[model samples]
Target chain A: MLGKIKKETAERWGYMGFKSLFSSGIYFNVFAFLGLVTIAGLAVGLHGTYTGYHNVYGVTRQIPWGVLISGYIFCVVTSTGLCLVSSIGHVFGYEPYMPIAKRAVFLSIAFMLGGFIIIFFDIENPHRMAIYNLLSPNFTSNMWWMGTLYGLYLLALIVEYFFLLDQNHSMSRLAGLFGVLFGVAAHSNLGAVFGMLHGREFWYGPYMPIYFIVSAMMSGGAAIIFFSCLAWKIDRTVLTRRMERAIMAVCQLTILLIAIILFFTFWKIISGIVSPEKYIAIQAFLTGPYAPNFWIAELGFGLVIPFILLIRSKGINTNLMFIATGFMLVGIFFMRYDLVLAGQIVPVFHALHVEEYSSLLLYTPSLHEISVVTAGILIAIVLYLGGEKVLNAHKFQKHAIVPPGAFICQGCGGIHYMKEGESQDDALKRHHRMRKVDREDEHA
Target chain B: MKLTNIDLEKLIPENLISVTKMERRAFLKIGLVITGVFAGGRILSVTSNVSEAFASGKDFVDQYPYKPHYSMVIRQGLCIDCERCLKACKETNSVPDYGYRTRILTKIVTDAVGRKREFIPILCNHCNDAPCTRACPTRATYKNKENGIVMMESKKCIGCKMCILACPYEARYFNAERHAIDKCNFCWDTRLSKGEKLTACSYVCPTGARIFGDMSDPDNVAYKMVHQVEKQVWVLRPESGTKPNVFYMKATRSSPWDLRKQDGAR
Candidate 1:
C-alpha cells in the first residue's frame, strides 16, 4: 500500500518542477507575503508581552480576556469540527464524505496548531504553564483537561494521517477513532472552561458544551466546502462529478446545522432575556456595546445570509457553495468572539451599584493582540499550503475511502479491491469477463 | 437593658474599644430596632449612626467556621476618607501606586435637612465559600482552611485572572512585578504571620474605625460586637453568597468626619 503511495507521490512531484513552484499565482504569493508579515507581527507581540501585558494589551483588571482568547476558541472549534465531519467517511464509511477526508484531516491538524499559537502568546509565563500544567495537574479544572486532551488529540491525528498516507487501512481507522474520541473530549472541555464558571452569569449553563459540539460540526462542514473549493483552484483540478456530489451533500448538511444553531441561538437569547440575573448581559450584546457583533457578524453573515444563499442555490451551485461557506467561516469567528467577550463584559459586581463599576467594563484588543492572532492565522495558511504541496492531499482515491461493510459492491460479486493499475469498477469488469472466457473454453 | 450575651470578661484590643460605656449600654436597645435598616438599600434610610451600629452588630458570636475565623468589622460612620488604611496597606505590602489591596467607596444620600456622606472600606471577603479559590485553575488563589483567608500562591499563578472576575468584591488586581494577581489577604502575610495582632489598616485607624479580630473566639471584641441578635448584621452583596468575613457598622459616638487619622498612620 505504501509502495503504491510512493509511486503516486513521485508522479505528482514530477509535475511539480522548479518552474511550476516559482510560477505560482498571485493568490499563492499573497499568502506567502501574509505569512512573512504575520511572523514579524507575532515577534512584536511577543516582545510587548515580555515587557508587560498591562502596557501592551488593552485588557484591564476589569476585563482580563480579550480578542486573543476569542481567536483561540475560533481556531480550535473549527479544528474539532473538521475532525468530526471528516470522520464521517474515514471512520464511519460514508461515500459522500469520502472526497474531503484527506483535506479535512490535514486542515484539522493545521487549525489546532494555529489555536495553540494564539493562546501561547496571550498566557503570561507560558513556559511555566508548560512545566506546571503537567507537574501540578489540576484534575478538576476544565482548562487542564482541555489542554491535555488537545495534546493527545493532535498526536492521534498525526498518526492517523501517517497511517492514511501509508494506506494502512486498519491502523488509520484505529488512529482516527482515537482522534475523534479525544477531539470531542477536548472541544467540549473547552466549552466547559466557560460554561462551568458560575460566577459569569452570561456564560454559566449547560448550553455552551452542547452548543460547542453542534457548532463544531457546522463549522467543519462549511470549512470543507470552502477549502475544497480553494484546493481545486490551487491545484488547477476540475471537480469531478463524484467530488461535486460530495460537496453538495456537505452543503445540505451545513444548511441543516445552521438551522439547528439558529434555533439554539434564538432560544439562548430568549432565555437570557427572561432571566433577570442575565438581562443586563443580554442588553449589552443585543442593543448595547456588542450589538454590531451580534447582529451583523453572528446573525447576518454567520447564519442568515449564508443560510439564504445555500437554500437559494438548492445546494447545487459550486460558486454559491463557496461564497456561503466562506461567509459562514468568517461569521462563526465572530460568534466565538462575541461569546467570549460578552461573558466578561458584565462586571461581576454590576449589581452592587458601586461607583467604580457604574458602567460596563470596557475592553478593546490592542494592535499587538490583533497582530498575534493574524500571525496564528498566517501560520495555518502556511501549514495548509505546505500540506497540499508535500502530501498531494487533493489526489486521494475517492473509491478506496468507502468504509468496510458499509456497502456491498454489486460488481465483482460484492468484492471490493482493485488489482495493480486498475480502478475498482475496471478490475471487477476484467475479472467478470475472464470468468466468462473460462466457461466458454470449458465448453469447447 | 440587660443583654444576656454581652459578656464583659473578654480581653479587648485597645483600638477595639472605640465606643464609650454609655454607648455600650445603649447598644442593646439600638440593636433591637436596627434590624430593618438595610431593607430599603439606601444608606440614608439608616438614619442615625447609633441605629447602624445596632443593625451591624446582630447575630455575630454564635457562628464561627474556624477556631479563629479571622474577621474584620468596619465602623462606617467614623470613616473620613483619610485613606490611612490604604496608605498603611501599601507600606506594609509594598503595593504599587496603580494597585491597592484595599480601597474606600463613597455614597452620598440627601435627606430633608441636607446631603449626608458615607464611606465604605472594601477588602477581600476571605469568604467561607470563596468563589476565587474555586475558580482558580491552578489553585493559585486558595482559601486558607485554617484562617479562612483567601491567599495567593504567586508562583503557581499563570496570571489567568479568572479569580479576579470570580471575585464579587472586585478586590483582586494584576501585580505586574509579581507576575500574578494581587489582593487583600487580610494582612495575613505582612502582619498576621509575623505575630502582629491587628491588620495594618485596623491598627492605624485613628478614630478606631476598623476592628479586626477572631470571630470564632468568644473573647474577641469582633465576636462581642456582632453577637447581639437584636442588632441586624449584614455583609455587602449577601446575594453573592460569599459569606464575607468583613462586617460593617456605624460609630456609636457622634464624632465629626475629618482626616485627623492621616498623621497617625503615616
Candidate 2:
C-alpha cells in the first residue's frame, strides 16, 4: 500500500527518487553534514529525556524555560508567519504572490515539524501530553489551545500541500484557508501562553499576542526571501520573472514589517521603563546583561540593518536580499531567546525583598539543550533541501493549454469552461477580465 | 547569643495597637477586615483574616467552595530559621537535597529597631485560582474540588515546567526522580490522605510558624481565625491576583513557646 501510494504520488507530482538526492556534490556534502548534526542533536535530546531534563538542561526552578523553548518558539513563529504570508497569494488570489505559495507552504510544514521535535524534547512527558491533551483537554489553558491549534494547523498545511502537489487548486485553497486560520489562532495563543501569566510581570500584557502575530509576518517574509535566494543558488532554473517579482514583493513586505517591529520594540522599552514591575527587565535590555542581544542582534541584525539593506537592494538584488535575510534569521533567533530569558530572569519574588531572590537569576543553556536546539534548525534545513529535490523545487507551469470541461481557477477558485484548443493562461485572463467588467458594471 | 539562636527572653512585644489600627483602616479602605490573633501576644504569632481571598468573587470564609478547604497560615514573624519544618518535609515527602517542598526566606533589615532579621516560611499557596493548574496543558496539576488543595498527577505531567513559571511563590521544582514538577501539596498523599490533620512541616514546626487546617469548617481553628475580623493579616504577592489559600501575619512573643503545645493538645 505504501509503495503504491508513493508510485502514484511520484507519477502525479513528478517526484524525483532517492538517487536524485545525491546528484549534486555540493548538495550531497551539505545534506551529509546537516544530517549528521541533526542525528547528533536528536541523540543528545533523547539522552536528556532518558536521564532527566533537570540534570541535562540549564533550566532551574527559577527559570524553567531556556534556549530550547526559545528555539521551539522561533520555529513555530516562522511557520505561522509563512502560512499567513503565503496564504495572501494562493488562498486569496493575489497574482504577484502566487509563485512563492508552494515553497512557503512546504517550508511552513517543515518548520512546524521541527518545532514539534524541539518541544517534544523540552517536555518531560511528551507522550502523556499526546494522550491527556485529547482525553482531558483544558479549554482555558493557553498552552492547551496553542498545542491543539498548532496541531490542527499542521494538519491543514499538510492537506493543503498535498492538494497543491496534486494540482487541485480549489482543494488546496480550501485547506490553505483553514491552515491560515489555525496558524493565526495557534500563534496568538502561543503568545497568550506567556501573556496571560499575571505573575510574570515581564510577559503579562496585551502586547505579546499582537507583537507575536506582527513579528511572525516579518520572520515569514525574511525566511521566504532567504530560502528563495538559496534555491536560486542551488538551481538557477527556478528563478523566473514571476518568481523574481514574488521575492521583490516579499522583500517590500519584510521591510515594512521590520519597521513596525522596531516601532513595537521602541514602545515596549519606553513603556516597560515606567512600569515599576517591568523596569528591571527593560533595563536589562537597555544597558544590562541583555544589552548586546537587544542592541546588536535584535535591533541591528533583525531590524535596522536588514531594513537598510532591503531598501538599498530596491527589493531587486537577490544577493543583497539573501545577506540581509541571513542576518535577520540570526537576529530573530536571538530576539526569541532574549524574550524568553528576560521574562524569567527577574526572579518571581524580586518584589518581596527576599535575599535569595534579590538579584536577577541566571540561566545558560547546557550542551544537551544547545544540541537539541541545533537539531531543530538542522531538521528545518534538511526538510527544505529534501523537498526541493523531491518536488522539483516546487515548480508550477506558468502557461499551459486548458483541458476540456470546467476547471477550478488557481486564483479565484471560480470554475471556468474553456473553448476547444484554448490555452489555460488565456482562459484565466479572459475570466478575470470579464469579472472586472462585471464588477465595474455593478459599481455603475 | 547568635542571631540564629534567638533569645526569647530578651524579646519585648512592642504595643503596636496604634500601628495595627492604621493597618486595619488601610485594609478597610480597600474593603477588607482583620480576623484573629493567636499565641496570646507573642512577638511572633499566627493570625488569619479573609474577605474574598479567592479570585472567584466568592466570599472565601462565607461560601467556602470546598467542603474542607485545606489551607496553611504562615506566622511570618514567628519563623526562627530553625529549619525543622524543612527537614520534616524533606523526610516525609522524600524531597531530594537539591529541591525543596517548603523553604524559609530570610529578610534582614539592617536598620530595624528591635529585630534586625525576619524569616518568611513559604510553600505552595494552593491558590483557589491556581495559575499552575491553568498553565498546565495537561491536567497534571489541578486544584482538588473536594478540599481545594492543588494536587499533582505525576504520571500526567509533561514536565513543561509551565507550572513552575506560573507559580508566583517559587514553590515548585523539577524532581529528577519523579521526572515531573514537584511542589508542596500540603502533604496530601503522605499525611492528609493518611488521616493526619497537619502537614509534616506544620506538625514539626517547633515555633508553630506553619499552621495547616481546613478553613471551610467554621469550628476549625483555621476558619475561626480567618473569620473573626480582629488582627491584621495578608497574603504574599497579592498583586499577582492568584488568590492564595495561604495567609501570613505577625505574632507576638507574649507566649511563643506554648503555641506548639497548645495546638498539639487541641
Candidate 3:
C-alpha cells in the first residue's frame, strides 16, 4: 500500500511539476510573487500605525468593532464545517464518502490555517493570546471557548491528515472524528459570542448559533462544489460514486438549512417589530438607512438568488453546482457584513432616536479595514491552492468512474462475486464474520 | 490590688449561686451577688456593640472603602448637557480623537417638548453588577473590590466586542486603532487617586448637576447628594441585573423597563 501510494504521488506531482517548471514556471512564480508582495504590503501598512494613530483598528467609539472580527468568525465557522463533513466521510464507517476523504482532510487543514491568519490580525495583542488563554482561562466566556476549541480543532486536523498520509487508518479515523467534534464546538461557540449578548437587542436571541452553524454548512457545501470543480478543471479524476453520493446528500442538507435560514430571517424581522428594545432599530432596517443593504445585498443577492439557484440545481448538474456555490459564497459574505453593521447603526441616545425610520449613525469601512479583510480572503485562496499543488491532494483517482468491474465493497476491497444462492447481505455478513475469525485465529 | 490566681477565682461567681432544696435561704444570698456581677458584664458588652456599629457606619458613610477606577457613577437629573463636562474632560486628559469618555445622551420625551426632552451625561456607571466585567472572556475588565470601581486593562484585551453587547449603559467604546475597548475611568490617574475633588465633569458643572464623591461615605458629597435630595433615581437598564451604581435623579416611568426584573422571570 505504501509503495503504491508513493509511486502514484511520484507519477502525479513529479510529472506535473517537471512539466510546469519548464512550461508554466513563470505563471506559477508570478502568482507566488504576487502573494508575497501582498503579504509584505499588509505588514508594512500595519507597522506604520506605530505613529500613535489608530490605523490597525477600524473601530471608533460609535462603532468599536469593525469588519475584521465578523470576517474572522465567518472563516472559522466555514473551516469548522468543512472539517466536520470531511471527517465523517473519512474516519467513520461512512464508506460512501471514503473516496473524497483524503482531499477533505487536506482541505480541512488548509481552511483552518486560513482561519488562523484572520484571527491573528484581528487580535490587538496576538502574542498574549496564546499564553493568556491557558494561564488565565475565562471558562464562562464564549470567545474563550471558541478560541480554545479552534486551537484543538487545528491540532486534530493536522494529526488526522498526517496519519492518513502515513496510512495509519485507525489513528487517522480517531483523529478525524475528534476534529469534527471540536470543529462543531468551536463553530457554535463563535456564534454564541453574538447570541449570548443580552444588552444588544439586535443580537439577543437563541437563533444566532443556529444561523451561524447552518450558514457555515451552506458555505461548506458550496466550498466543496467549488473545490471539486477546480479539481476537474485541473484534469483530476471524478470522485468515486460513493463519495459523490455523500456530496449529493450534503447538497440536500444545504438546501434544507437554507430554507431554515429563510424561516428564521422572517421571524427575526417580525420579532424586531414587536420588541420594544429593538422596535426602533427594526423599523430602521425595514425602511430606514440600512434598508438597501438589508434588502438588496443581504436578502436579495445573498439569500434569494442563492436559494433559487440551489433549489433548481438539485445537486446534480456540475455547472449549476458551480453557479449555485458561487452565489451562496457571495451571499454569505453580504449576510455577515449586514449582521455586523446593522446592530450598531441605530444611535443609542434615546432622545435622538428618530420617531420614524431615518438614516442610522452612518459608517463606512476605512481603507485599513478593507485592506485587512481583503488580506484574509487572499490568504485563504493562496493557502488552499498551494496545499493542493504540493500535496498532490487529489481527492479521487484519475478518471475514477463506476465501470462494470467497479462493484467492489470498499470495506474489504472485495469484488462481489455473488454465488447462485447468496444475497448481498449474506455476502457482507460472511465477509464480516470471516474477518473477525481470521483476526482471532491469528491471536490464537 | 493585683489579684493572684486564688483571688481571681474567688472574685468569679462560680461559688456564689450554690443551691440545695433544704438550704434555700443560703442559696438566695449567693444568687444576689452573682446577678450583680452578671449585670455589670452585660452593660460592658452592650456599650462595645454600639461603638463598633458606629465606627463602621462612619467609615462606610464617609465613602472611604470604594473608589472609581475607570468608570463614573452619573446622576441624570443633575445634568443639563451643558457640554462643559465634555469640554473639561477633553482638555484635561489630552484625549485622542475618537469619541468622548464623558458624553451626554438625550431622550426626547413627548415630542421634544421643553419639559420632556431629557438629556443626561452618560459614561461608565461602575456598577456593582457590571455586565462588561461579567462578559469579558479574559478578565481584562474587572471590578475593584476595595472601592467597587469597574476597571479595564487594555493591554490584555482581544477586542472580540462581546462586552459592547453586554453593557446596559452602552458604556464600552472600542479603540479602532488599538483594537481594544475604551471608556471613562472617572479620571482615576488624575483625580480619584489623589484624593482630589470630583472628576472633570463634576468639577465643570456650574449647576452642581453632576456630583461625585464616595457613595459609601455619608460625609462625602455623593452620599449627601443622594440622601439630601430625596430624589427618585433610575439606572439606564436595570433589567440587565447588573445592579448599576449610577443613579438618575427624578427618573420616571418614562425610563425603559428594568431588564434585570424582566430577565429574572425567565
Candidate 1, A45-137: lDDT as tens digits: 878877888888888777878888888888889899999998987788776676677778889989998999998887776776777777776
Worst 10 residues of 1 chain A by lDDT: A12-21
Query: Which stretches in model 2 have alpha-carbon errors above 4 Å?
Result: A1-12, A398-444, B1-49, B52-63, B227-230, B254-266
* TM-scores of the models, in the order given: 0.82, 0.85, 0.75
The digit string of per-residue lDDT tens for model 3 on A67-96 reads 766667657766766766665556665545
- List-wise, what DockQ does each model earn? 0.32, 0.59, 0.24
Q: What is the TM-score of chain A in candidate 2?
A: 0.90
Best by lDDT: 2
Ranking by TM-score: 2, 1, 3
TM-score leader: 2
| Candidate 2 lDDT, A1-444, residue by residue in tens | 323457766766757776678899889889989999999999998998788777888988888899999999999999999999988888887756777888999999999989999999888878888899998887888888988999899999999998888877889989999998999899998899899988999999989999999999999999999999999999998887778878888999999999999999999989899999999999988998889999999999999999999999998898999999999999999999999998999987786687988888888899999999999988999999988887789887431212346555767544478767777778889889998999999999
Give the root-mean-square deviation of each candidate in angstroms.
11.6, 10.5, 16.4
* DockQ (model 2, Cα): 0.59
| Superposition error at A337 for model 2 (Å) | 0.6
Best by DockQ: 2
Candidate 1: stretches off by over 4 Å = A1-28, A398-444, B1-63, B110-113, B249-266
Per model, state how many residue pairs clash. Answer: 3, 13, 21
